[model samples]
Target: MLRGRARREQAAHAGGTPPADDPLDAAQERRVRAVLALGGVPQADLPDGVQQVRLRLLERAAKGEEAPRDVSAWSAVVASRLALDWHRAKRRQERLGERLAALRQPEHQPSGEDNRLLSLAVARGLDGLPDNQRQVLVLRFYADLPVRSIAEELGVPEGTVKSRLHTAVRALRARLHEDEVV
Candidate 1:
């Protein structure tokens, strides 16, 4: 009886099965389910490669081949990496879908009085300014860029950005003030 029991114990450990009385079996199953759910890997959608990796990890745990202290840490790392990969793949699919939708839609054309008025105002303002001032104002306000970003985009220094912004603001304020008076 002692020999038979020993053989069974050895077999269980070698085959990666929990012993008949192992308390961790139920806890391990629950942990695996939670990890899979949190990683967004539904049983039906689990890829073969991922499933294989998870199974190998679980088998090692079941056989008491992996350290008890490291199991949770390893499991968490795997779950986090899987979740990150899923999110990246989902984002790519969303971007592709958006591109396809844009391709299917007709190009937008401005046709309203408001659009025309805005265009005319912009054109008149741009025409009135010197080229450098116009470029600065367009980069600063029209593009809604910060001074640092504008400087970087224009390959100029931050001081130049500040000066350009100050000059443009004064010019626009003067132009608007004159238009109001007229």
Candidate 2:
């Protein structure tokens, strides 16, 4: 699909008419492909994402904003930002699920107030950890992956993965104990 899009872009640049049915022009297609190649978005989403970029531009134009003077640059930025937003939203959803699960624990269930506090504390602890430790913890606990799997996924040694998880868990425990609210 990427190859086809690239071909179409090149063809457009070479004076061939773009696909009449395609929503995105050659430049927009190029920008969308560039954003996808940056690695967050899956290749399968190219067609829909390209169309969505065009639709987004159309929507902005409908708001009476002038067309961007540099369409390619603008499209690339918008597409990249949108992919980042999607990635963050997915992480937030996963974190919310983890917190909800923690809140549902038998010990925390007796008081809605306590559950809420514990959930918030966990979120804060997760956010406070260093990126390496937090990522290892998330892969270990949230993703339910074993140490070996996490090490493979993260391209690190299993010992490193375990070390990070242990440290992250310890830090979270300390934070919870400090709060005395959860």
Worst 10 residues of 2 by lDDT: 14-23
C-alpha lDDT of candidate 2 relative to the true structure: 0.78
Best by lDDT: 2
Return the TM-score for each candidate structure.
0.34, 0.44
Off by over 4 Å in 1: 1-119
RMSD of 1: 16.9
Residue-wise C-alpha lDDT for candidate 1, range 72-160, written one tens digit per residue: 55655665577666676677667667765664465664457645665566567678888777888887654545789878888999998
Error of 2 at 143 (Å): 1.4
lDDT of 1 at 124: 73
**Candidate 2 clashes between residue pairs 3 or more apart in a chain or in different chains:** none
Name the lDDT value of residue 17 in candidate 1: 69
